[model samples]
Target: MREGKRLGRVIWAPVGAAVLSGLVIGAAARLLMRGIALAVGGLTGMSLAGTVGILVVFVVLALPAAVTATARPVIMHAGRWVTAALTGLMAARTGVSDAKIIVLADDGQLTPITVLIVAFAAIVVLHGRLAQYLTRRLRTLPESPAEVLPTPDARPV
Candidate 1:
């Protein structure tokens, strides 16, 4: 319902929040995936062939997912920033200024157990959304001719 109407600089609040949240989720997801792998593989004990297979599956599942999950909000925020910057409105500052320091201090910490719980939840949610988004995005991409399997090498399409 609130998609339309700039409502002034308040727009940045949501946009900035999403991007920051997304980056946090991405880092968390990668760490979680790595931890899962380490637990299942024990850091050094899985057989080479099995480890390779697991790794291939992990890459197929995780990398694109993490990227898309983290990228959507970033792209949206960039669009907002670009438009606002051009319109002589507020601009995003990527500096270690006092305000940034305050924001970081405020947002970067919590009770340790609460931090772990929230971080785990964020990563899992982002992973699910990322997988869905990436699957849809991949489906929308054009298939390359090379990806088409030849008909038994006996017939050409």
Candidate 2:
């Protein structure tokens, strides 16, 4: 791959890691939600079917984490984009249903935009090392004066 692409990889590493973290958090949230659902379902006397439903929820909840681990960069980028859109969409409304209108009005303090900015910042910060890894520098070979290859221009016509 070209150095340029590798450069992006280096830049995106931290973002990818953060994305993975986000996926983990999301999975945790889903797990909790499913657990709650199962408990409620059981209390309602929903039976083994209710517990089976929770198991299904667990499977669904685990998918994002698995996907993010495999493709964290893409996930991070998508999340950044989606969060930005959601923030913008939320910003345009007046007398919103939310009790926290200021959160939407603000650029990112409470918005998903915060995640985007952070991921972008992370990518820019660590891009160099990533680029180096992707496009590793040519190794220097020890040589005597005679070991050097003659330049084309230095050769006799």
Best of the candidates, TM-score: 1
Candidate 1: where are CA atoms >4 Å away? 1-110, 145-157
Q: TM-score of each candidate?
A: 0.27, 0.24
> Residue 98 in model 1: shift from native, Å?
38
Give each model's whole-structure lDDT.
0.39, 0.38
Q: What's the distance in Å from true for residue 117, model 1? A: 1.6
Model 2 pairs whose backbones collide: 10-127, 10-130, 11-123, 11-127
Determine the backbone clash count of candidate 1. 0
Prediction 2 global C-alpha lDDT:
0.38
- Evaluate model 2: give its TM-score: 0.24
